[model samples]
Target chain A: MAPVTMIEAIREALDEEMQRDPAVVLIGEDIGVYGGAFKATEGLLAKYGWERVIDTPISETAIIGAAVGMSYQGLRPVAEMQFMDFIACCFNQMVNFVAKSHYRWGGPVPMVVRGPCGGGVHGGPFHSQNPEMWFVHTPGLKVVCPSTAYDAKGLLKSAIRDNNPVLCLEHKFLYRRVKEELPAEDYTVPIGKLAVRRTGRDLTIATYGAMTLHTLEAAEELAMEGIEAEVLDLRTLAPLDREGILESVRRTHKLLVVHEDVKTGGVAGEIAATVNEQAFEELDGPVLRVTSLDAPVPFSPPLEEHFLPQVADVTRAARELARY
Target chain B: MELPEMKYPLSREQLLDLYYFMRLTRELDEQLVRLFRQNKVVGGLYSSIGQEATSVGTAYTLEKRDWMAPMIRNVGGLLVKGFRPRDILMQYMARSGSPTGGKDGTSHFGDLQERHVVSPISMLGDLIPVMTGVAMGGRYLGQKLVTMTWIGDGGTSTGAFHEGMNLAAAQRAPFVCVVENNQWAYSTPVARQVPLHDLAERARAYGIASYVVDGNDVVAVYQTTKEAVERARRGEGPALVESKTMRMKGHAQHDAAVYVPPEMFEYWKARDPIARYETWLTERKVWDKKTKAEIERRIERELKEELEFAENSPLPEPEVAERGVYCEGCHTIEARWERPIEQLQPPKASVQAAWTVSDFGGTNGGGAAAKAHAPEAAEETKPAAVAAKAAAVSTRGANGGTKRSARAAARPKRRR
Candidate 1:
């Protein structure tokens, strides 16, 4: 079996789900004939046809609204945002309609709103954004960001089947860059569960999406300095895996939360707050975060690199946390 | 004012059913207003006193298989869609037995199982795309069903409305959008909202058909909507029917509507839908004093029973409020498939593009100024041949009764 890229893994997840369930449909801009902006839905149109692979107009509100409506009719629709940053355009639909549907009416809105997110590929402010915090704050919605190819496919498959609105934020930087030979059989990673990417004892580096790769790289760097940093990929952000975070913190006695999103109001703040609330005694030191500066992602490679948390940032944060 | 003779294919019972539903809608809201006065209604009570025909008439065209989403003032549509008067009263009162189980208030309740009614989101014009998706999903399931939803005059200005309309048109989905141009949107006039006199003209930009009808004229609204529904069912894409009417009362029970001119009220008062509909029924000898009195008496009796039921209904326990946020095995939503799924399989489901170039624009152009009830007014106001073409697609249907004496007392004055 050939090793598949994260993009291929995601496409496989969608292809397999559509073939397995007739109710699974895809709707997004450039997703059908254009094969998606990132080609994540490439070849799906020809195989499943247009009804299942819908090329919607550039209307995020309608894309998500239509997905909600489709879900109401027992169709599990996976609506893609051409760029997840444009999700702000449909914020009202997502928050007010989709998120509140189940709570307000007990209608199971089984739909997946998946798209590429996060800054690292020099996609700039509009294309590169980690907007999961918005949906994370929303109660009824479940948010997930997969860092590896295996988790990308597994988590997406689970999200599609889940009877709630799930936001699958794929890191654009890791889409084709990360590759792994996946199993031949079907599998799904449970939502609201974190993945332990690497095991260590000295400190725990909690991260997700593209930052997971950087965290792992930083862990390798930390290992050279005799500091064993365990990398915990916080895949699901909304229902933050508090137990998993505590268990890792309890094992390592030090926590260093890392993410590509801006530091202010980022997922790291929630993770820090959770640890302080539940596992305050278990922590050997104060919880620290390695996150991007609170500013728009610049287009310049150097500035964007500066704006995003890099491998060095995690290593530096983990080193400081280990010393603390 | 004399109305033009328009042939309608409706039975006497169906015609009376229209009147019954409209009167029921008005009577139910009047009762809700009374409930509001008693501090039973949990939220604001919106009165559809004047726009009953627009909601009831347009919604009446829908078959049981079709889907419809109603806005706040479309309580009449809820009745027409088979929602019990008690279901609505209890919903406003936030009782446990309400359709939403006291989770929501006002017209924010839908019957997905039986009536196929999609609940109205507080954010206006959001349902347009939702119904469009329903239409699309229905097509994928190989079911022949048209989806409809109502939007207000102000709501038409929403980005969702434009985007949803475009999606419907581009996909050639079986979708109908009723723009209830009831003059004002929470104190702002339609003129203040948009420069266009006819909101239907907004549909032309999307390359879909649009129709202008006298919303107060129940028969006209029914006929126009029926035509649009048939067009959508035929895969002619979406159609926007702008039902021109007025919101006779304030935005809700809380609003005094002091911004509206006294003459404006008197003018629309002279053209009250129920009064006009009664006159239409009487002039045609469809119902005499005895029949009208019997219908009114039955409505009163029905309202009393439903109100009692609503009052008797228990409030949801505090613990119950904590439940049902996510599916978590609490509820199961299964779509009723009327058609087989095999048609969506492979060869039959294959399509070259998302959009099909339907004959939607010229000749029998999608735009029409349908003057079904207004005849002998002026040469410029004559019905277009397109309206006749649209009529050839559907059969026929019928609108309201009266203002309650409690309405004036229920309405609160605006605070300075």
Candidate 2:
């Protein structure tokens, strides 16, 4: 087994999907001869030809709109937003049309819109943004942000084959950094499912996407101090795994939600609210959260590191929760 | 087409069929307007009215298999392409049997399997790229089919329109981009928007040839569209045709029409498309008052039956509300695999190539296009169980309808 990057896992998933179904087509800009801006679709065009591997114009709106149109026509289209930040251009179509296609027309837009998202490498505000909250607020859309290669490959395959519009946020940070040997055969992971990264009985931690790996490292250090911590990877943010969270909370009796997104209105808030709603009876301490400060992710690395919570922060937060 | 060495010219009956579909548009409009006035239809919309030239004009040139992406006002085009009259009327009345299942209002009337009409979207010119994709799809399937999109003056301002046009040009997809500049976008005149003197000139920006014509004259519209369609079918790529016409009614229901200049109406009114076409045919002795009366009677009788059928048609069951949210059984069974946490491993490739943006067979600037709104925030967020309570924002926002944002507004009518 080889250690593969997150991007490779995504490519493997797409390759498997294209091989499995003729109707699975890829549409995005620079996805043809040039592969992709990041080259995630390097060999797809040659294998699939012009119809299945389509390179659209620079218009995100048109890409999204056409994908919606094609999906309505029964083609399982995987539309890639060249960059997640560019999604703003198609915001209306995604939020208004893609997300609501089922809720509105009873029509399925079984499609995957994957792109480079999040910040760390100085892509700046325009190029890097964590817009998961926007889709989180939207009811019809299902959002997937994979923190590990295994989850990335599995979740992407599921989204591409899904009959609903799925937003897959692939962190630019994890594209090359995260690696794992995906299963040799084709596979899929169910949406709305959670993965428990590391388990303990004192304090529970919930997070997703790139933050999952960070918090797991945090949990390892917390264990050094005899402070047991439970880490839950909330793979699907929109359909938050409440059962998983509540169960973990009931086990640990102390809950802490964490995310790389800003603190206000972040997914942690929703989980916190729900824990208070459904499992408050089991609470032994007020739920704590390790989230990005309420500010734009800065350009400087030092500031960004500080802006984004680190292993020490999560371990410290858990230590306090353990004491409480 | 001359084909460099033609034989006989197009026959009288061929011209008559062109007249035939155009006449159907006029009759449908007249009947629908009267129905709205009688309170039979749910909403009042702008009739193709003075723009029949473009609607029937372009469609008459299409093969049944050739695709069409019509604008909202192209009911004539959709109907001519074989969309059922009852289906459309049912749609207008927001009835259950409508292809959109009684949800989307009449902006784009389309069917993927039938007549190859793409479902409609209403952000004006946004479907240009999509229509281009349809053409590209036709080409990729090696069907040699052309996909045409009908646009208006307002739609010309959209980025999707430009993108679609450019892509079509680059890929040489068989297409016809019809511009129906009826001199009005609700209240603004074409003069107030475009200063190019001719929209056909904009085509030059992309190296695509274009033609201009009087959209009020069905003969001119049909003739020009036929030429463009033929060119596309010949693999010569796309053409943009600007049809100059007028709007005969207010934009839609409750329009004060204060913006319409008195002289402008008088001028276009005297040149009423239906009347003008009828007169043109009659002077040529092709049809007379008696025959016209017979045609009108037939349309009237059929419209009556269609309306009756739609009005009495049963609505979709409230219980089946969740149906069609996705394709029925379009699910791929997940090849589930599970391993204990101990077996988990990191991925192999440190980084991989990014996915290329595939150039779908060819078919921006921006002033942002817009939304499907929920009636109220709370109703949109938390839908009311009572259909009446949530009816205002009830549409699930399919076919690009006005979206109801209140989560509660869109729920299926609950069982007692």
Candidate 3:
């Protein structure tokens, strides 16, 4: 109904959910009168009041720890780790307490933790990172990295509504840069389901979060070279959409995995292995991946471009698959 | 406040709770040893066999609402924390009916909604953060409640211990961080966990208060704990109370204590705190030989009851194995307490499907049939940030609930 930035759509989702469910509360730093650092929580404090839209101290541990306790006590608290990179600060709370809560205690930690993750701007290594693989490795945690305004709004709403703990990684680069006409009314996107963003036959490009946008761009560009790339936006990471992945792989008979995370130990490695194990026969070329180099994302603009996976890299990988 | 002095002598009732629980610990320990021999209780047990007074004295003083996190070795702490001896037995065997429904082993215990007694776990001092969070609950809720967590001298080596105390002290949270310093940590001793002479000294780092007591002396432990709890209730933050005692048994059932040198072992046994307390009470004419004999006999009987009950209890059913994993009951924040979906959907539907499908989406629903992933519009991610917000102000604060804020800013602005 309205063409909104990914930021407003998320703010709308939070405002609406908070309005519909009194049990839904927000816990993060500077989310109150200050709004969010990115203003995703704009007007929330004035609308819901501070009691509902709390601004916490700069303690990720406290944010996540409080979320765990709040979730335990029946509040669907949405905890935000300001920058995804700083998540290492509360690694134990996330991996040990929140993630393991369900499997460890047979309790559902029905809380959603959303944050600005991934780097495309000159935010540097410290600020700009797609650290999805960390939580992806954890069992109880459900990781979602949304690249579109639609997926961002829908998934944020769904993650909040889900009965389990979910981590929604909003690519920092996509927050303002991305725009789409989102549904005016309420909506929710179920987690653990992959989306087929564009149809193709030559090769399958599996990616998520910010990388989804890049892969799509690469797909459109690859079309000029007579290669059709079927792009699978793996919105959910932990519960990888293997069937969707295999289907695309089976159809194209080739796979080209892409992600912003470093190549080694990224989501691509797991998917490639799974395809090898489950859909080994459905192959024409080797499963290739275009990912960030193992080196930390450089702070310099030009160097950082070389450091991360760009549209060209995805295109090159797809071209190779097309040739094979 | 005097160095190693007892305030009020432990009373008959207090003594009985301690003695009986100690006896429960004793019988449970003996049973584990037998079980080990029989191969029933797997893994070497970390029993509170000898250090019974330490666990019982601290836990018995806690009111029903006082939350506790016992260390792995503190079986007495679990038993004394109102965990039925049967629950303990079921837990040791990892049965489903046990508090952890057999999902956890002998140590990992928990039942959060109940009187906050969490089972002892072994990331060493990991429970400290949970304990601190519980204290945060007390502070936020404006309750006189205190969270008491038992850690071993060995647990001092863990980061959680420091993180928990630091946070508690910084927030002035109500917490009694008890260090059951029974001389040895799995045969390594205090010299290993820390170089400091006393674990109590570590409190200086957190800026919380500290107290050291004879863990074996029930009166001393009770007195020290009372002071810590009182200080904690005063919002003075947390206390690092180090109860220096001796390990009566090895780390667990099979430990021959080969690492413990004979001379040091003899010295610790010579100063056994329980026996010393018994003699002190007797010489004061508070308890005579016949009375002491009767108390021991009474504890023995109670121990028998707890053991038999535990041994006889049924194992948990398999179907509900995933029940409390993350607390489906978290949805219950009201009188009717419907799931978020139930609140929005037709009420009649919830009633009809109550027994079959869970409140959330069906487990077996294909992405196609499921509401979110059906070949329709791609679902957005809010964790799904539900665009359909709930009514802003219904049942905001009731029950033992605390309201920190209405809408806590949950996430950052998406950086375009």
What would the per-residue lDDT of candidate 2 be over residues A151-220, giving only the tens digit for each residue? Answer: 8989998888777889999998889998877788777888889998888988999988788878888888
Report the C-alpha lDDT of model 3 over B1-416, residue by residue, as the tens digit.
11223343455566655656666676777777776787667466766755777787788768777778777767777777667767667677666667666667776767666656654445676677667665654444334678888888888887666666665655556778788887788878778658887677787665456666667666656766776776567554567777776776787777888888789767767666566666656666666788778877876677677667766766668876655544344544321132333332223211111112222454444322222211111322231121112112111111113231111111211211
* Each prediction's number of clashing residue pairs: 0, 56, 60
Chain A only, candidate 2, TM-score: 0.97
Give per-model TM-scores: 0.91, 0.82, 0.78
Q: Kindly report the interface RMSD of candidate 1, rounded to 1 decimal.
A: 6.5
Looking at candidate 3, what is the lDDT of residue A187? 84
lDDT value for model 1? 0.83
lDDT per residue for candidate 2 within B1-416, as digits (tens), equals 11111121335566556566667777777777777888867766667777876788778778877888778788878877887678777777777787777667574456566567766566776677777666655554446677788888878987777777877765566788888878888888888898975676677666554666667767656665666677677666677877777777778766867898899889888877677777777776766677677776777787788778877876766765665544446444221122221111112211223332233212221211121111010111122332232222221111122331111112221211
- Give me the candidate number with maximum TM-score: 1
User: CA shift at B87, candidate 1, in angstroms?
Assistant: 1.5
* Superposed Cα deviation of residue A209, candidate 3 (Å): 0.8
Task: Report the number of the highest-DockQ candidate.
Answer: 1
- Cα lDDT tens digits, model 3, A19-90, are 787667787877766778899887776565433555565667667765665565456789877888888887
For model 3 the local lDDT of residue A288 reads: 95
Q: In terms of lDDT, which candidate is stronger, 1 or 2?
A: 1
Tell me the lDDT of model 3 at B170.
Answer: 50
